[model samples]
Target: MTAPSVVVLDYGSGNLRSAVRAVERAGARVTLTDDFDAALAADGLLVPGVGAYESCMRGLRAIKGDRIIGRRLAGGRPVLGICVGMQILFARGVEHGVETDGCDEWPGTVERLQAPVVPHMGWNTVEAAPGSQLFAGVEDERFYFVHSYGVREWELVTNDRTAAPLVTWAEHGGDRFVAAVENGPLWATQFHPEKSGDAGAALLHNWVRTLT
Candidate 1:
C-alpha cells in the first residue's frame, strides 16, 4: 500500500513547516505547495492558518484556495483544516470589530471567546462527538489549543435525508466553543494538532486513514 498524498496548502500562512512535518509523521506523502492542481489532486488537503482571519483569507484568496476547497469538497474529497484554517470554514469571522466573509462552508460566526482570559492556550480535553474517527484512539487525550476566537454556536442543521455532522466541544474559563467538526468530506480542528504531541499525531493518522 502506498502512503496517502497530502498537500499542505501554503498560502503565506505562518508556521506552515511545523504542520508539514507533523502530517509527514502521520504516515502521509506530504507536499507543501500553493499549486492549485497539486492541492486539488492530492488524496488529502491540509489548510493551515495562523495570525488574523482577514489576512489568512487574503492569502487563501490570492492562491484561489477557496475555489480549490469548494471543488474538492464538491466531489467528496477529504480536507483537513487547522487553527484559523478551521475558523475560515465558517460563514464569517469577527476580529477586532472587523468582519470578513469566510469560505462559507458552514453557517456560523467566529467571534471572540467569552473566557476571562483571552487566547485560551495549553492542553484541554474535548468532548468528541459520538462515532468520531478522528478521536478514535485519543478520546481521553488532551489536545493543544491557542485561540481567542471560535464558533460559539453550532448552527448547521441537517434534514432526515442527510446524516448530521459530528461536532466536538471544548471549554475554557467558563466559556464553551467548537473544538472540531467532522462534516462529510470536510474535517477541521480549531486546535493545532501538529503541536499537540502524541495525541495530535494519533489524530492526524486517523484523518490520513480516511483519505482516498
Candidate 2:
C-alpha cells in the first residue's frame, strides 16, 4: 500500500512547515504548494492557518484556496482545515469588532471567546463527537489549542437528504466552542494537531487513513 498524497496548502501562512512535517509523519506523501491543480488533485488537502481571521482569509483568497476547497468538497474529496483555516470555513468571523465574510462552507460565525483570557492557549481536552472518525482511538486524549476566535455555534441545518455533521466541543473560561467538525468530505480542527504530541498523531493518522 502507498502512503496517501496530501497537499498542505501554502497561502503564505506562517506555520506551514510544522503542518507539512506532521502530515508526513502521519503517513502521507506531503507537498506544500499553492498550485491549484496539485492541491485539487491530491488525495487530501490540508489547510493550515495562523494569525487573524481576516488576514488568513485574504491570503487564502489571493491564491483562490477558498474555491479549491469548495470544488474539492463538491466532488466528495477530503479537505482538512486547521486553526484559522478552520475558522474561515464558517460564514463570517468577528475579530476585534470587525467582521469579515468566510468561505461559508458551514453556516456559523467565528467570534472572540467569552472567556476571561483572550487567547486560550495550552493543551486542552475536547469532547469528541460520538461517531467521529478523527478521534477514533484518541477520544479521551488532549489536543493543543491557541485561538481567541472560534465558531461558538454550529448553524448548518440538515434535512432528510443530508446527514448531520459530527461536532466536537471544548471549553475555556466557561465558554464552549467548536473544537472539530466532521462533515461529508470536510473535516477541521481548531487546535494544532502538528503540536499536539502523541494524541494528535493518532488523530492525524485517523484522518490520513481515511484517504487511503
Number of clashing residue pairs, candidate 2: 0
- Please give the RMSD to the true structure for each candidate, in Å: 0.7, 0.7
List candidate 1 segments past 4 Å from native: none
Best model per lDDT: 1
Score every model by TM-score. Answer: 0.99, 0.98
Question: Residue 49 lDDT in model 1?
Answer: 94
Give the per-residue lDDT digits (tens) of candidate 2, residues 11-121.
998588999999999999999999999999999999999999899999999999999999999999999999999999999999878899999999999999999998999
Question: Quick one: how many clashes does candidate 1 have?
Answer: 0
* Span of 10 residues, lowest total lDDT, candidate 2: 13-22
